[model samples]
Target chain A: MIPLILYDIPSKLDGTYWSDNITKSRFVLGYKGLPFQVEWVELPDIAPRMKEIGARPNKLADGEEMYTLPVLSDPNTGALVTDSWEIAEYLEKTYPEKPIFSNKSKGLIYAFGNAVISLILPAAKFPIFRASQILNERSAEYYITTRQVMFKVKISEFSPEGPTRDEHWAIIERAFNTYKEWYDEEVGKWLMGDVISYADIFIGSILSWLKRVLHDNEWEKIVNWHDGKWGKLLADVEKECKKV
Target chain B: MIPLILYDIPSKLDGTYWSDNITKSRFVLGYKGLPFQVEWVELPDIAPRMKEIGARPNKLADGEEMYTLPVLSDPNTGALVTDSWEIAEYLEKTYPEKPIFSNKSKGLIYAFGNAVISLILPAAKFPIFRASQILNERSAEYYITTRQVMFKVKISEFSPEGPTRDEHWAIIERAFNTYKEWYDEEVGKWLMGDVISYADIFIGSILSWLKRVLHDNEWEKIVNWHDGKWGKLLADVEKECKKV
Candidate 1:
């Protein structure tokens, strides 16, 4: 049987996948032990490629549709899915034996992810801005240009230095600490007691992405925060996050 | 065994409990089959009562701590709990039988509650504004004065009669429909599949509030929304939401 195909974007420096969104899909595939092949689509070519595959484009905040990567195609079932969340849903539905999300925890996982994201976005803006730096020339240009429009600020102003940057990191540190409390309350190593599910993958995706994009010193700070909670989570999922 | 004492407020029409906040604690107590007694504390008297019981005050937006109702004291454990969410936590911890929140889903339940509350609070303004009308004279004055400051809108302007009200209800209907999809996808009648938990109680509390405070026509519209999810949930919980 032909392996599933994952559309991913590569880091310009090494021509390997570096996108957190792409990593999210990759991690889920690895977790389920699903055989999948990766195809690199540069940032600029994503729209046309998505259009070619009939993958759904995301609606931007202003109601404009924008194409994105981490598009998954299942050769076995002839199913195509776009967006990391939808890809998780499609994979879980088509391949149910090794489930990423049990029916009981699916909605709650989404809710938990949303809550964490809303808290972290202010701090996350820093990593997102840094992420644009990893794209290949044309992809980098496309990413920066589009993001500037979306962010309504130049990339230079995105993650500032001094007190403002300190505040961002402070918020980031505090946010991680805040979520650690949830994990602390639980009985098992995973978020949902003994069960390992999509919430772990979602969080692991963010941490993996941060590892690749953040400066070594900044990354060190994260690794140390919450008694190495972020670092340990990355370690836990790193095996399943193998490059396709 | 001395029954748990729950501090509550009553409607002026009769000295019976009509508060959704108080109803939430009552519902949980009933669900746990824990015997509880209610003592009515008029709105004006809530602060003194809470202070007297050593129940913690809720911090306002500006960091001012203010007393509120639904303060529960467990005579068995000598535990004094304030806040509905905390009350759920305390009950589950102290009782440990017929738990409102299982250890695994507790954090996720909180996450889901926050998500729903964030969406509903705007539309909920109508009922909250109306709630003041049910209070006795001094309580009514205290309720309106505190709320008008918190809402920063006069009671007259709180739930306006034109396009703005339409927009608010539209948002309310849309929010319920959106959450209903989560329930629809699940295998069981409850939010988190077959296992009933605090998420259901949280949703039920808001629905109970709406039923008591919304106009007949407005409440009817909610009863029919999302295939009568609101109405059915009220039915499901009303048995437990007794006037203790």
Candidate 2:
């Protein structure tokens, strides 16, 4: 069997993979026991490279074209799928024997994942400096330029200190607290139940990104706030990944 | 079997029930084919009446006491459950023959419901004036006072016609579009799968509230925004409810 080709953004400084979007795809592959090899694409080359591989841009609800990373190239079928959520769906359909979304409610999980992304984005902004430090000079320049265009401000403006950072952290804390409330209400080891689902994969990937970008103390604060659930989940996913 | 008693806030003018919290319980009962009767309680009377029925104030994550409506009293088990989400869980557990949450991942659904609540709160706030008009004078006064305290502003300040209201509506429209993106991703009739779940119940209740408070044109604009999914879901829920 040919190994799947997972296209991901390479970190500038370490040449290591560190994207939440790519982590999501890696998680699903790891969970499904699918053998895959990474194809490192630089930050600036993602769009053109993905398009060269025949990966089409995903259309938003308003018909806006969105090009993103974590594009998967299935060797056996010669199928190239783009977008993390779409890749998950493709893998689930292609590998029905090992289901990521056991209940076939990927929509609900996707909704929750998007909500988490929105909640985490504000806090995630505060860690831009740390994120930039890990990027090589070229990728760092690309990252900062794109981010500035998106945020309409300098990357340094999102420093992880002072009143503004505190406000963003507070928003993130409230979002997690809201999640914890729901988690506590249900009797489950995983987000879905005793069995893990793509929701866990999505959350685990987000945590992985935070772990990569946030300082140790900052990471610990968030991990501790959710009654150790976040830490435990990352550990659980790690254990699950180790099995394959 | 004795009918379950559902305590809800009464509509001031119509002497009807219109609370989203109450609709959650009603949806469960209707879905389960359970016999239940609404015990109308005024705004100020909710806490005392619930206490009289042995429903204690719900404890928040921070251990704060919260007194809210949609309290259910099941005579068969002498169980009193407060809070909408809790009531849904109670109903599901007590009457397992007809399941509302088929996935057994109530936590995920609850998280989605809470996200919806947060997203809709801003847009929903615009309809308060219309909501107040339906309330009796006493309940209206109580509602205004409490909302003023909660929002730290006068109730009249939340009128539907203003630049601020448009901004709030834009936020809600974006939130709904985000949801529509997820909904469009999966091949399912409901938020979860082929069958309706508590998620649909929660969403439907919010729609019901909007329908009750907003003018025909305003409500239509929102209903049309989400690819007609919102309007369709409410209709589907109503059809499902009619079965009981």
Which candidate tops DockQ?
2
DockQ, model 2, C-alpha based: 0.67
* Residue A113 accuracy (lDDT) in model 2: 75
Compared with the true structure, all predictions reach lDDT values of 0.79, 0.78
Give the winner by TM-score. 2
Backbone clashes under 3 angstroms, per model: 0, 3
TM-score for each of the candidates:
0.89, 0.90
TM-score: model 2 vs. ground truth:
0.90
**After superposing candidate 2, which stretches have Cα over 4 Å from the reference?**
A12-15, A58-66, A165-172, A222-227, A242-244, B12-15, B59-66, B222-228, B242-244
Alpha carbon lDDT at B43, candidate 1: 90
